[model samples]
Target: MIDPVIIRTMKTVKEIRLENARALANEGPAEFARRIDSSTQQVNQFMGPSPTRNIGDKLARRIEAAFGKPEGWLDVEHITGSDDASISGTRSAVLEKLLPEGSGNLVTWETPDDLEPDDERVWIDRYDYRYSAGNGVIQWEVRQKKALPFDIGFFKALGVRPQDCKLAQVHGRSMEPYLFNRDMMMICTAKTRVKDGLIYAVTFEDEPLVKQIFKEPEGALRLHSYNPEFPDKIIAADQLEGLQIAGEVVYRSGSGLAGGN
Candidate 1:
């Protein structure tokens, strides 16, 4: 016998999740996406206004930067963060912390950023791949959203678990002729062993960069740029944080090059 009250409660929760998902796709700002007017109203709707946009807020910014521009509360739920808003937290919350190490990849796919709301694809996949996102949370039917033909960001972080993250979008042409501006690349974040030659994502002087990797003896990691014009950057293996191979470039997309523009 189905309990009507329990079913109603489940429906309410599902409705909220779906409504928020829709808003997220349309507005690109989870907290501000609800057109309910007034900050207080928005806070009440979300149940937590955020203390000056701290952890969850920071993760939301990253989600917008990495995936699609924010969208709904639940959309940000499974992104990069320690709270329910982050991808990790969302799955943990609904799945009740069932995320184990070495699970499948967790890439986020979504509808195009410029698509119109009425466009059947308005609901993008932006974050968390089909397999990971469906671990046991969202219903099987609701999981049918297929982002655009442009799903991407595989590389090292594609499906690499929570701890190990080697991800950074390419900037400048220093590694040019090979990797131009806006070209995204990922490296293994584990920093396991600085083998001989493995490209890594390097952060030097607070500046993040992606370049070919090389590790030398005496505990020193080297960075070799493909563009002959740019000189190589080197640092000690222990100091590898600045020269660690976050992950390798597994997939690239955008424009029209398959990964396109």
Candidate 2:
């Protein structure tokens, strides 16, 4: 048996991810690409620079590109690098300054002519998004350090950006015995909006759930749990503040599934 809390949280988390995989399978390349593009823009706008971190111009462009728009931007027509953005060159140039190739500790590299810029890998240690259950919009957000009451080293590899390739974590026990707590979920993070029957991050009253999301007859969302013992909950669009669908959970591994890692 898993910690009920972990189980509770991770179950919802996995539900969101599984739903994503199904959706991607259904969409065509063009439609899928468009969705990814929109997602990228939303991330860039919301997760800018973070604390004390500067959003390098190249990475910005690369992030925008990952979503599949133009090389510089997906939502906007302009190529990256306004006068302020163009201040420095690409990663090779930037890394050389901070990393100092001579320091054997860090990988050494010189910029090749074809070298392109990109975002750092962001591992899905845990999902920490917040929303109002009564009105689920991403009203607030947290990350591994904030929401996770445990230590997850996955962050060492990825740093919470598109370059990280995007990942999510399972966070409930709705799907008991199958998905437990702190399960690192691999998500494409290319989805923009919410879809029915897919597990997603939903705000319930004031808490965010990594729950499997289904549509209700009343046009509200029905958050379901696998255990059956747990009551299936319904959340109308009007009742929600907003929704943050963290793509779909593609991979599951971590404390809950693999036996207390």
Candidate 3:
């Protein structure tokens, strides 16, 4: 016998698919498929009258990520609309439902609607790449234009220039208790100097990683992870020439500390 929970989940997925299709009516199916990392033909099959495939858990999560929706977003029923305020409100409600009480201030999904003429916004370059916190990932250099916006004052407060900041996402749990998977990091590209007891986004042997670095007395470097399961990696002074310090992790958003380590 089929489980009722499975049936309900499938129904929810279908509803979400239809709603997303309607929302992307202007961009059409091709763009929607691109966003979800699926082919247009597969998308049509899922949306067709006689469907041959079902939305699995992995695909549902991928859809949510592509649309910038929170996890389990597709499992619930949401009111679809063309109104901007209504859409924003719905997003806020979803976030509130997922976050713990008193932690609501940690995340904000809305852009400030009230800004004085003198208040300037700085756009930080964001890359469609993830820096592995466990096993390093091969670095990809795809920059998304106008990814994150910050108030000009924000840079002044951090003592870092706006132009020097870049945003990237972290993947893996090797740096757990300090940095979590899928955390959005604000990297100061200008600060490449090796500093002890600091987290950095670096490339070693062509693999990009987010790890805390400690300079040894003999000019060697130790890459550290907060999660004890992962042992620290020590690089000999002579091999340091291969290490490229892309930037120091100045700020992070997600389930981690906001300040640099």
Query: Which candidate number would show the highest TM-score if scored against the true structure?
Result: 3
lDDT of 1: 0.42
Per-residue accuracy of model 2 over 235-258 as CA lDDT, tens digit each: 776875554554544445553443
Worst 10 residues of 2 by lDDT: 44-53
The list of candidate 2 runs beyond 4 A from truth reads: 1-172, 187-192, 240-247, 255-261
The per-residue C-alpha lDDT of model 1 at residue 83 equals 55
In candidate 3, what residue range of length 10 has the lowest lDDT sum? Answer: 103-112
Q: List TM-scores for all candidates, in order.
A: 0.34, 0.36, 0.52
Worst 10 residues of 1 by lDDT: 127-136
Per-residue CA lDDT of candidate 3, range 1-261, in tens?
986663333455666655554344336567878898887667755543334466667877887788888887766656544585476456445534644345423223344343333458776777745444233333446555546678798889889998888888787898887788887888888898988898898888767788999988788999998999999999999988768888898888877766665
CA lDDT of every candidate = 0.42, 0.44, 0.71
**Model 3 stretches with alpha carbons more than 4 Å out:** 1-118, 130-140, 143-146
What are the root-mean-square deviations of the candidates from the true structure over C-alphas? 20.7, 24.1, 15.0
